[model samples]
Target: MEVHAHSHTERKKWTHYLWEFLMLFLAVFCGYLAEYQLEHKIERDREKQFIRSLLNDVSTDTVKLNNLINVRNQRENWLDSLTYVMNSQNPRSFPPADVYYYAIFIPRSIPLRFIPNDGTIQQLKSAGGLRLISIIGYDIGVRNLTRIGEVEETLINDYRGIAHYFFDGIVFDSMLDANNIPRRPKYAPQLYSFSDQNLHELNYKLFSIKAYNRASRRESKRLLQQAENLLTILKKEYHLK
Candidate 1:
């Protein structure tokens, strides 16, 4: 029988094993860091997209608010003139045509209303969440402005209800031209009743509508300011145009 000499291999030292373990640990740690960075970048990108969409919505709202403010100014002027004519010592003495002109605006006027542009905000609520745009505080402002707008509509309708006691629908209906603009009627305008009581109650209703209209306009201006402020901050923070 032939005896074979056993081939001996050098065993790895403890330090070598330790070095291998360190390299493996470092590989895993670096991979985890890379993954975390990627996720963070994705989140940041999503946030920026949301902000851009919100900016567009706010920009649109600002333009509408400005236009609405101007309309409200005109409406307020009409209300003032109407109130003056009604409160006169002798309301009946005033031109029926003038009274009819202003009374029609109090009822069935739709051009004076405003609703906030909240499409992006609604989308955010369904998507990630409002938390993404929490810094702007625009959502709360829009909601509040919407509530005010609804209330103004209700007030306007109520004013119309009270106005019928003093104004003649026939006269008001005749004053509107083909374009729905108040135009001088071919026939003389008239009122349903010019009694002191009707005039008094109608005046009160006008006052209510006027107050709410002013409030709504002021709220719109405030919301406009907030939108502008948020827009500035977002532009500066994101280096956006």
Candidate 2:
């Protein structure tokens, strides 16, 4: 009876140890699963936030572009009205004020150098339009047509004189490098750093606008959307009412 009782006690002890071990294993497994789930959730939230931020940036840029276009249209309309009045008064006797208008009232250049030629400039000027030349920068290397450095050199050289002569502002194309350019990362530094030399040589009231690239449509759209949202926030924050 004593031996049987001892055997029974040992059996119970072994069973208790087994149970404790199983429970501990289960607890560790549960903790690991919880940690993994929490990490995954955090990662997903970060990605979503980044996308939203990029979209806001893009939207703001779009709004700025729209505002610029509206201003240009208004100027053009005013010039047209002035031209009509001068022409009605007397075509030949229309004062040399037209020349002054053209000298000042040209539209700023786009990335493609979309500027009216001398004749068009003269006509618009005569019509009392300002000679605003759009400052443009073209990225040449993407299509393998020209090297980026070569293009940059040419643009700098070509526009250096033009900058002084005709350009109202400098529009830099591909202004930011791939890394520095806005992306999904919350705190990615600018991909391309602007050299002092480039900045000094291309000096003008800089208007940094991204040129439309087919390859980056989705990203661009997201960024533009983000930009627009930011603009709204800025307007409100800055009391730009």
Q: Rate the local accuracy (lDDT) of all candidates.
A: 0.79, 0.38
lDDT of 1 at 202: 79
In model 2, where do residues sit more than 4 Å from their true spots? 1-9, 12-21, 71-94, 107-241
**Candidate 1's TM-score:** 0.86
lDDT of 2 by residue, 1-241 (tens): 4555343433567888899999999999999999999999997665445434433433444654444445445444544543353335343344334422332332223322212112432333465543222201111111221232234334334444543332222212222246433112222112123344544443331211111121123333343344445545545543443
User: In candidate 1, how many Å is residue 71 off?
Assistant: 1.3
Kindly list the per-residue Cα lDDT of model 1 for residues 57-168, writing each as its tens digit: 8889899889988888988998998999888777778787777877777655467656667887888778856763544377777777778778777777777777767777
TM-score of each: 0.86, 0.35
Candidate 1 residue 85 Cα shift, in angstroms, is 1.3
